[model samples]
Target: MSFVESRAAIAEALSTVEGVTGYPKRPTTWTPGDAIVLVEQIDHTLGVAWQVTWRIVLLLSGDEGVAIEQLDELLPLITDALQPLVYVDTATPEAVQTEGGDMTAVVILARSE
Candidate 1:
């Protein structure tokens, strides 16, 4: 799939989450207290048709405890919400920091199978 389509699908899935701005949007497009920003990144096509690896960066503010908790809680929730987009079951997350708050890269490999 194309990168645009991949991000659109991911954004759709993420929007289902409670309090999450799931629709693909630039961080600047959102308001304050959004809790987290789902920014699509480094997405490209897989060797196979309809398959793609999507990297979503979640920007949130908090400490390690809070960051860990968000990752733990959102991972499955994000996975489950991706209907029709097969969750790869091998994606992982990386933690980081930003001027806005804590951040993590949630790598999700999916196929619109």
Candidate 2:
């Protein structure tokens, strides 16, 4: 269960954050809060060697600016946590917003050196 381990690592990195829940066994039944950040399992590339990118989604209950700020706050944390691994590319803002809140998903690419 590499994905599970990866998810766990991400959770451990984000432990200090006020409210964040990594891949929950029961997402439908439980949620962190209005400002929720979920670290999804790593999506792997099917080929000779396996490389992955973690999809970290942020659902904030504030204005778009607030959401972006939170996203910014998490990036370095994530980068630091995944020490051996690294961000594949610049975070594409795909930063979408909803009523009174914002949602941003950053796909971090990585390889084991």
Which one is best on TM-score? 1
Output the lDDT of residue 36, model 1: 31
lDDT of 2 by residue, 68-97 (tens): 676677667655654643353445545444
- For candidate 2, give the lDDT: 0.47
The local distance difference test score of model 1 is: 0.54
lDDT of 1 by residue, 5-110 (tens): 6567677767787645554545654322132323333334566434444445554335656656766777677668775665545555655555665455455545
Flag regions of model 1 displaced more than 4 Å. 23-25, 29-50, 101-105, 111-113
TM-score of 1: 0.61
Candidate 1 has its poorest 10 consecutive residues by lDDT at: 31-40
Each prediction's TM-score against the native? 0.61, 0.52
What are the lDDT scores of the predictions, listed in order?
0.54, 0.47
